[model samples]
Target: MRRSLQWVMYVAIKSIVVSCLLLFISGLVQAQQQDQSVTTFKELTIKSDWLGYPTPETVKSHPGARTVITNKELTESGARTVEDALRNVPGVRVFDESGTGILPNIGIRGLSPLRSEQALILVDGIPVTLAPYGQTGLSLFPLTMNAIESIDVARGGVAVHYGPNNVGGVINFVTKRIPAKKTMTIRETLSLSPSTERMLADSYIRVGGFVNDKLGLQLQGNFINGDSIRAHSDTQVTNIMADVNWYPANNIDIKGSLQYYKTKNNLPGALTPESYKQDRHQSTRPLDRFTGDTLRGSLIYNQYFDNGAEFSWTNFAHRSNRQFFFGDALNADDTSTLERSSPREFLVYGSEPRLSFYINKGIKQKISIGARYMREEVDYIVDARDLLTNEFSVARDWRFGNHAFAAYISDTFFLFDDKLKITPGVRREQVYLDFRNNQTGSKESNPTKDWLPGVDIGYQITDAIFLFGNFHESLRPVQFTQITFGGAQAAERADNFEVGLRLTPLQNIGVNLAAFRIDFDNKLEFVSQDVGFRNLGKSRHQGIETEFTWQPKQIDGLDLRTGYTYIDTEQRSGQFKGNELPLAAHHQLNFWANYSRADWNWNLNGLYQSKSFSDGANTLIENEEGSIGRIPSFWVWNAQITRNFRWDKRKIKAGLAINNMFNHNYFFRGVDFSRGRMPAPGRTLLFTAQLDF
Candidate 1:
């Protein structure tokens, strides 16, 4: 362990030295480029506030398929979990395994949803995965819903701007920014499950004000304590965030943010079919637990020139420690117990700098160039003990380090009287990874490089109609565990293609339609026998998605929205060839309606998912434990009502929400091999109140 630690430190130091040199050179270039002459052409407005809610117009203007869930929608829908907020988004699949929403398994366009490893998750444009190259799981999202201002989901053709792990897409959580004026907000919520007699409470507070004309500051705190549907499954989460924004010059701005998060959750292992039938709320593994602590800090600087040019840079660092304990209890009848503790520590730091400018000579063009460098280190330890004899059984320690460097450039050219646009971009990335085991004195190193390219084409049919198409390639390197346990697994790669159209034919109506296809090669799959991951054969996913929104002009305070998605997934080669991908639902639909008048708002939403297989073999044989089988179709409904009022010069809002309004009995996820079912919670209710001062 000592020797491995020393080697990690050495590599870290060398990486830092190289990063400093590169930063210095980039700074010099930026300084010299600042004096360039300005052009009259307008630059393609890069979405700087990926942290802010985008309007419908903004979504329509994007070059690729995208969705934005706003705070208003969150509030009106009474969404307590990220999955709830995203339920209306087409092509998104969320498996609420924990029921409390602490650990969410999410997938996009038929991709693997386990631990959300296939997608990229970010907070304020900074990656937040526990370990991007080592663990690659979004075990903990730093911020809660109350502290989040919006969520931006960009799908298809995102690799040029964001590096690896864009195979599915990018989900960015944007937190509330410092207020320009003095403000304070407080909110509290309580949820109850009548059947299980479980209760959950959430609280949030935010205070912000301007210190001076050039400076502003904000502070936010969030707390959540909840009891899950299963017995003994309790969780607690706490978050603290601080922000400072300064405008030193008329065209220059700087922002800094710090965040802290801590969480602990008790796991309720899956139950057998007979056990579930007897008592779905009973826990099989009551001693299992998960805990994590994370701290992150970031600084951003932006400079805007009079000549339609902009430069921005961000530097960020994060440290997190997490531990998980799992108890082996397949059924209520088991007597023997196996306890395992896996603890990991992650350290990550990175910088991103981008430049944008416009040219109007002949054909108008908007261009952007950016560079990124990041380094991560992880220390992992695992220990096992037998409960019967109280004896130690197994112990292991591993250390890994990863260094990544990338550069990308893109240009959007306008042709045919600014009605047609083409964006071509490419990213060059190189990754260096090293792993070592102290006990075995084993060391392995792998350095990989790739050049990914993408393009987006858009044609404006009219002021309110647009057509767009995009193609991009994505790659995900083999995770540390796969490398260490599976002996150097190959990277996962994919090609994504999408075409979409946005239309606003009527004043109160908007519609979006899209078709997408993803070809995956060397996909990663876990093998139980080897207890490791391997490169599976090729697979294909093709889908069509549509969304429509209508606000009746004749009926005041009434709005309607609906979305539908159809996916066809197939394993092209291997033993499971020609079989539908496991857990990939074939069809999904979402509908929502809202009415507001006289300070009263009423909302209703529904979700439907088609049946899917639970395993790669498309197994139909029902196991006694319900661990492997075909998942039947299911539907869920939720409703909410809110009232706004003022008392003694204070603004107050109150609301009530009922989930699974129809009392639907269904499961959102399944265990492929065991057929073990994780039952979904029944009817649940929640009440919320907010005060503004």
Candidate 2:
């Protein structure tokens, strides 16, 4: 009862504070009222299918929590990779596994970050995972930081449009678009690790132009070569892409893209407790390595009708191959003479068509209908090699196939002079999957279907305050391994809830606060050797996320952004009941501050995460394997300084960045292949230069 009273008091105080802030800012209400006009539903609904929220106003009006990390912010922060740029997001957590950012392990709201399987990752609205429905794990991430223009993350109210693995939400990496004017750019970045005595370089080139009034073309390339902090950790990456846009008529638009990406990296396998104490930077597994490549293509078509209606069709296809080599021992300390290798290849194709129209007879409404079809094929092989004989033999060979279909319908209603908006939608999914064990001469098929329903509401309480809420039912389809094992038959389901407030009390300041809860069911977990995989009972995850931004009028050319997240998770059943989930930190905070003066800019930023358990058992003691223990808290800071100059009518920029300025020592445990401690990179310095002609 005492705790309940305190919670009530807290809620009352927050409400009072918000009320006072709104009243204080009401003096500008007249100006706001004069400038405010209702945006037509058609105008707001018709935009690029890839964009989560196209404009700042749309973001504010959105019925759920959303964030956009812009290119300017990414550059000013001196971000070395996409992972570096995403660190500041309120509810997202990114753990470095490959050190080169070639592989991403992203989690949201206390979900497991392993392989980022719970989250739906997209590149310009197209799925980037090996297989969207059959195998959601992103063994090969094809995005390069130099080619990204922005990142869009949506936490809720998105299930009606996206699916299969969206319980954690949707993260879209938007690539750079073709410039309207002819331009060519060249950029290079170099970084040095003092502890490992290794140097890395990143090169980028972009050429774009408009050939005529109706046609535009662009080409981009990025190359990376480097060594991580640990021994025997060499990395190389290549990305090449071409984009085209054509406006054949006033009402028709066509866009297409082709991309190729490849990466090869050596893994410094994890270390045991004793080995870690002796030398954390030493690598015992010199032969462990990973290599991946992808070739992808996409096309989009849009047609606008005179009656305030729009139609769009999108198609995409990709081929990907990934391979990993590791020793045949559970512990890196073991002097194993045998090695294991797993190679997987995937072929995926998808198509989607959508239609949106306006109906303004009784009330302003925007209605949208869409359908999607996706097909996937996977070939998997496992091989074992003996060091004594230098011979290799196949251990397992499997083939997997999936056919998925989905349809959705949604209508958004505007009421109370556009101050109140409500949207209701539903989506249906049908999937058929089959797994063939070539070595065993056996095959199994699993067919499943589900319906997802969601609703979103947004109300403008005042000129400076907005309230939004959403409830969505989402699911994660049965993956490749789950099908291969033949124990889990149904998809994992979850009910997601979110409520938030977007406040702009002052013209120069903005704030966002949101509370979210996820009730997950039918979770899949590895059981005993006899059972293989099973559908675990239930789990609950709840959290609070808040962010603040200020561009104070008093301090010219200075900007500040900060955010905090609090998460609480519980395993509701099974042996781990009442225990916190692995890698789910209770508290996280991040901040970025930038100052500009006289052609020079300086930035300081940092991230802090509280201690978390490495295993579901919540073990407090350090285990011998270094995989079942409590992870200590850490603080990592970065700083950058840059200057702009003019060279014979050409523009030039140069900068220096220091990562891990404090020389913090941190490690991530229980990653793929090696369930032991993996040391993070130490202090590093980067130098960058760019030229535009």
Candidate 3:
């Protein structure tokens, strides 16, 4: 573990160097123009402000690959869930097995799933992960899409300020910061469909004000209820949130927030081979049952120094418990052998503490760099039936804990005073991992040490065009979620190279094109099994992603966003090599158009992904020397309309959103196996209305 003193010393030295740079810049500013000397970035309304705040000026000077979705986009999309809204963004692919809530395996760049361990989900600067179980944001997400102010995606790699687990990237869902004035809000939504029906209610009310600046505090909550196509299956979730902020000091601010969530739902597990023959969405066995809940709190402190440097820290913690079983019924052997039995259970508790340093002005460079430390601890216990005894017993007890030490430095310097921009950066990370096994002592091992390094670069070709290229390496260890009786696997290593261009052929329109190739060694691959999974070897992922967005400055209310992705894969060395990536499409296209005016808002969203194979083998069946399995490609659509009304100083917006608008049923992902598949949700309509005063 890195001692606190080491962290402090690391930051102190960097801060001293940065302070000196700032002083030098101050001296030069008198000779040059203030506005002209600032490193101006191509600002977008979507808030690429991923590195810091929403000021377009601040982001242009940020040091990493960043992308954002604005508040308007979030509201206009009429997306049912947070992940639903983000999937349309380039470089983001969300694969859900069923319509059962959100199943997010959010991959960035060309990371291999098996080795893709790190990726952080942040809410109000707080890290959200179900510890012990290692289920990415399982306890914290499924957020109501409309409440978010924007979604910031820090692509490639980022520092640990937002908390570790983000080797692939960091996604921060910055919710609506409380308004500066007293206000009240009430919102409700109802959806009815063949596969599911849900009702959600949430409200927020701000009270009181700080000394000079307006003070703000608010409360928000949501409830969702639904059922799947299977037996003895139903799902429910309730989330409550509170936030308070104080900006008494003009240059300093502090905010505290808390969120509580509960879910009585199923994992949408796989069905047997026989069930597929009857109906892809049908199941005979009572393969259902799951329940879970979570609670968390966070405190964030931010300070802005007059010199243009900013600093912040986020402290957060959460706990969760979830259970799974074969519906509410018990099997003959399992029940007959035991006097009393309970469903399988998993529990987690964790805390994430992050510190960030943002320096916007420097003598010789336009830079944003910082160092961060994250300590996350997790514990897991499982109970399964014995082979002969048939009675369930303590099958596994595991403890997963890691402390990460990371630092990054980057500078984007301007040549010719301001025209050309050149950026260079490097990051280093050291991780410590320990696993304790109660299943048996043989499984106990502590690989407590590893180091990874990263580098990135970008340059401007013309004022309207930019060229960027980067190469970095990252390590993905076998997280707690991958633990199985087969023995934990070794960490996977990846070396990635990418080169791209960001172009603006016309003002108000932006286009980005990137081609990437990643090589994976010791990639994690697994197979179906009870309790755990079976491992497979090395694999690779390489692909291309593009995005085009238009938010015309002159147009009063018109915004269009579109994205296309093309991915190519080579197994390298595995049961399946030179095969395309499965559970992922080779080609994906999405387009969204929105028109918002004072009285009404109109929106349309559409998506189509080329067919993809299932599982790593790409092969369908195995029992009788081999069979066939293939999932055909599909298309999907969604649209919404909203109108606002007022009642005695209160503001209200009513809207209807239709998913799968054409009612064409499809597969969430191509399914190929006796394990059966889940049909995508049929055409569904959601009615929602919100009131604010």
Candidate 4:
């Protein structure tokens, strides 16, 4: 603990010194350019200011594959969960373990989808993953769909700006900001299932206004209560957030935000094939439950100089507590029912500073430099007891801490009369972790460092066509759990190569195609029932993703969009060599169409996935219990209709949606060693109403 404190202090002092130096340089630059009028830093009104929520045009200029889902797409899809919204993003895998969509198992490319630990998850550029270097479960997503303005997924070549676990990519959730004028909005939604009656009910309210010419305030609240498709499964989630934006000077802007979230979920354990056939809605273990709460705060500062240079800094902190009580069905022997309770507390604090400036040569060049420092601490305890007596006995108690520092610089040079762009970047990252087991009086520590470099090149072929390519290197550090139990584990490294094209044949039509390959070394594979990990040596993932969108002028308001992905993943050098990775489908497709005329809007969407193996061994034959085998391909469809009206200058909107239109039955995730499978929800209906004043 003393060492950790000292390290924290050292980083703090270094950050202060660097910040002062940057400020001094910025002041000098401003003074030299005082003759020119400085542009005032506007309040946070556009979503693009947030790190990940880049606009479509911005995405076209990005170095590698990127997907951005905006509010318009969210509204048209009527998606109740993040997984639903991400379906259109190719190369992303969503394992629907929780029928209510509260606990998401998300993966990008061919990475493991276990708890979404391999990917970096952020909210408005602030890390939200619980215990990033220890557990890293995205169980507590504080904001609801109503509060989100955009979702961005960057597949690779992002390590230069985002650090640490940028192995798979970066997923950033951007929340709505204060509007320019006073506004109040209320929204309500109800979901139902033929098998379980009422499935979910949600309520959300938001108010935003300008307190003064230089100040803005916003407040939001969301409450969601739902019953899962499985029997005895219930969930409740609540979130409250507030934001204040102040412009103390014409060239300076400051924003502060705070958010609180609490959630409880009743976990219905998986069931065998016979039980599923008898009744899919029946729960095998009804007492399993999970609860969590999180509090987060952030302060942001931005300064603009007359020479069009910008400096920004953000400081953020998060604290979270989570508890899980679940049936140990996999280890149960039928003689005695066993249960386990795991409780964890996580604390994280971080700061990031960035400076960007433009150089006007023959062609303009943009250069950005950034530095980040983060410290995280986690305390975990596990207890075991009999199901009947409920007398718990301590099994394990562990404490873990991680300290990380990273610095990066990126330069984008424009050539060929601003038609060709070349970007080169490099990032240096260092991570240190310490772990102690209180019950056993044992301690361990590990330190890892890496230098990542990348280059992106883009050429405009024509007025409506563009071609781009990128190559980057990224790394994922071994988590504390793996190092503590599995002994020493090597950090995973990945080299990604990608080439893509964006073409706009017409004003209303867009097409994108990308082909990429990733070489992974020292890959870690979960073993021992996911309690530990084993070095898989080497692996490779190669895939192609294509997307098309069209808005026909003939059908004034008609919109159509579709995307497809083909992935080939192999374990190159391991015991499972020549085998396909588990749970990664070979083919996936998504399609959506929406039409709007006047006050009425209608939309339909569908998703399809090919077969996938359930175990690393690539098990093909289905067992008697249907637990270990290849999952068959399946198709699911959804539709929605909305109507808008105005009464006395107050706007009102109503919508109805149907999910799983055919009631298809399929499993996206599976447990190994004859464990039961995770089932997806059946046909469901949802109704929504919104009022704006």
TM-score of each: 0.91, 0.92, 0.78, 0.91
lDDT of 1 at 422: 93
The digit string of per-residue lDDT tens for model 1 on 333-424 reads 75637788888888777788988888999899988888988878888899888887899854888888888899999998999998898989
Q: Over the full model, what C-alpha lDDT does candidate 1 score relative to the true structure?
A: 0.80
Tens-place lDDT digits, model 4, residues 1-693? 656764664454445434434433444454455543333334533221324346787787666788999888888778888778887788888776667877777888777776777789888887788766555656555657778888988885677677667767898888897776667999998889977785788889998765445666678999989886777678899988877666778888877777788989887657777777878887666557788998777778888888878888888777788887776443344443667778887777788888888899667888888898888888888888886887779988998888888889888899988789898989898889888999888888878788999888888878798898988888888787776774677788888899998899999999989999989898877667556777766988899999999999889999999999999999898778989987778999999899999999999999998998877789887776666789889999999999999989999999999989899987654422115767788898889999999
Model 2 spans with C-alpha error above 4 angstroms = 1-55, 328-336
Candidate 4 local Cα displacement, residue 576, angstroms: 0.5
Q: Note the residue pairs that clash in candidate 4.
A: none
Error of 1 at 385 (Å): 2.1
> Between 2 and 4, whose lDDT is larger?
2
Candidate 1 has which clashing residue pairs, if any?
Answer: 626-675, 626-676, 627-674, 627-675, 627-676, 628-674, 628-675
Report backbone clashes per prediction.
7, 0, 6, 0
Error of 1 at 532 (Å): 5.3
Instruction: Give candidate 2's root-mean-square deviation (CA, Å).
Output: 12.8
Residue-level lDDT of model 2, residues 509-628, one tens digit each, is: 999999999999988878876787788758999999999999989889999989999999999988899999998999999999999999899999999999989888999998887887
* Most accurate candidate by lDDT: 2
Worst 10 residues of 1 by lDDT: 36-45
